[model samples]
Target: MASYSIGDVADKCGINPVTLRAWQRRYGLLKPLRSEGGHRQFDEADIQRIEEIQRWIKSGISVSKVKAILDTNQGAVDKGWITQQEELITILRCVRPDDLRFKIVEYSQQFDAATLIDHVYIPVRQRLGFEQNTVRNICGLLDGALIEYVANQLILSRKRKGKPALLISWDDPDRTRLWLEAWRLSTQGWHIDLLAEPVELPRPEFFPGHHIFVWAGKLITSRQKEQLEYWHEQGYSIFHHNPDLTS
Candidate 1:
């Protein structure tokens, strides 16, 4: 009957403590015991349940639907991405900036960055791409709110100690995606110094012993590939992130 604190469970499950609280308060996915001080206390069974929840989420199911799936012990019946996309589209169509930003923050608390990016953000953007000019204006609003949200997340992440890394994009037209990727890295225990604009590759000696993450929204040219290889040879830990290739 050993019990663990919320931080302990978050570390063990590779989940944020904020996300764990969201699961309990918003989604009812967990019901941990409260100590005399009103602190959350999780038992071993709770840990196992968290792993199960992670499995469902990794399969592209939204946290909002996880409770029902677990209760029924059934496979995902409806598409989570579609549901999330529809909700977001409705919010955007309302043309209310505050509501959109509020939902973005709420989503960040509920779901991990990767899940939010892949399931909700990317799919919504793609769906709106085929729409008319007025709808496309709404898409631009979403982008602005997302950029602001991720930037604020990055600032908060800096208060924690993590390995120092530089995040930059070379030839990515969308700065919002770059910021989103930077925030994603921050969640992975990286203290990110993000350069949102495309810049020439600096000398490895400038950031000695630092991880350099390069993001390209499109296919990299031959010269860009050579530059990356050269940086690798120069003892810089180079990681190329191409959303086009991965997504």
Candidate 2:
């Protein structure tokens, strides 16, 4: 039962101290004892638990969901039927091993990607703001899940049936922004070329349609706005979009 400081554990585990703090604060993942001076102190069991949690997370399980497995030291979880919105809120309120993702993929068998996004995801998203956490944390947690499950499905569906459009962001678009535009364009039967950051757009001739979209977010700089306007002036048919992530 030797003690290790937070910095020492982070160095040994190759995990950022800040990330560990986030996991603990958000998910109750760690139960470290505090020192007299209020520093976190970890023991050998804590180190081993951290490694185990890291392995499960690397395999795509969300932090909030890993607690029960760790507590029980069990491998099987009972599967039950829950509404997609409920499952999604579960992903936010209490993680359960990518179960939300599993449900979306499962539902896709019965519904097309567009239907799922419109009915399941969009409705769930609208209801997310009333939750107990700060909007930023709530958005951050759920957005990650959407990216893993919903966004990936939309991207793949986009590839299957359409002409590719040029999509770029002034910087990395918010998860909501990227997924929403991707869904909208994909529903319109267009493929996508997503650039997560500010970069030069592809030459117009190469894409033929020159149907470019700039997925701007709330934090656009004056220069980025000017760059988008310049693209508009060049007759490239560019559109700027910023998804309403707060809602």
Candidate 3:
């Protein structure tokens, strides 16, 4: 669903612009679509092929041969791992903090944050309906384990990456969402300043230093939404999970 320019492709593929152009002209290595201005335009598929070409080149394959391999359209496939949602729910219901943190760390490292949330955490939370008597206890224990292990891991990851940005959660900020955002940013190599609890808008002077500000929460008041828009209108490079604002 994304289109990329030659420069974007060059940066992401780690190929110089000159070399990428040469690959197109010399070996017909790319078949990008044309823009309205007749400039070369690439899609996500092109990016994937470019990554594959890079891998082959690193493995002692020649550039000339790279095109042919791509033409054949052979590539490695991703086999996604399955999660044990019910088992996790059972453990959380039993309030096993030690065992819970172990599973959280293992899965967080093995899979990305989004996958862990969607496949593991979200499913378990949904299944732990109001009818379940242990739901309250499970919720409390789960939150504690996540904050101690998983959230801290994301914090460390962001610290190591060092391209600082801010994450400010609004009223009653969802820690799970914060963890997911922090981990997502960490994976993309950003130094994150996560305000895990609800906080007022950071002072304007602080804005200059951050790459961007992400306002995250499940619910937002009109006042909160307006404040976010005010920051956005001020050219603060702000992003929010609120659908209405983005849309």
Q: Choose the strongest candidate by lDDT.
A: 1
Model 1 TM-score?
Answer: 0.62
Off by over 4 Å in 3: 1-83, 129-132, 158-162, 200-207, 218-226, 241-247
- Candidate with more favorable, higher lDDT: 1 or 3: 1
The ten-residue window of minimal lDDT in model 3 covers 73-82
lDDT per residue as tens, model 2, 166-201: 776545524564765676666566776666555444
Clashing residue pairs for model 2: 65-95
lDDT of 3 by residue, 1-247 (tens): 7899999988887789898888889988888998999988999988877776776565345788777655443321123222366567778767788888788877776777656654566435544532356685477677667667655766577546467677666544456656555656665666676777766555545667466555544345677678768987887766665322332
Question: In order, how many clashes per candidate?
Answer: 0, 1, 0
Arrange candidates, best TM-score first: 1, 3, 2
- Which segments of model 1 are wrong by more than 4 Å? 1-77, 200-209, 218-223, 242-247
Model 1: per-residue lDDT, tens digit, 44-112?
989978987886675446788779767654232154556767888998998889989888888888888
The true-versus-predicted C-alpha distance at residue 50 of model 2, in Å, is 44
- For candidate 2, the lDDT comes to 0.64
- Given candidate 2, what's the lDDT at residue 240? 69
Better of 1 and 2 by lDDT: 1
lDDT of each: 0.79, 0.64, 0.65
lDDT of 1: 0.79
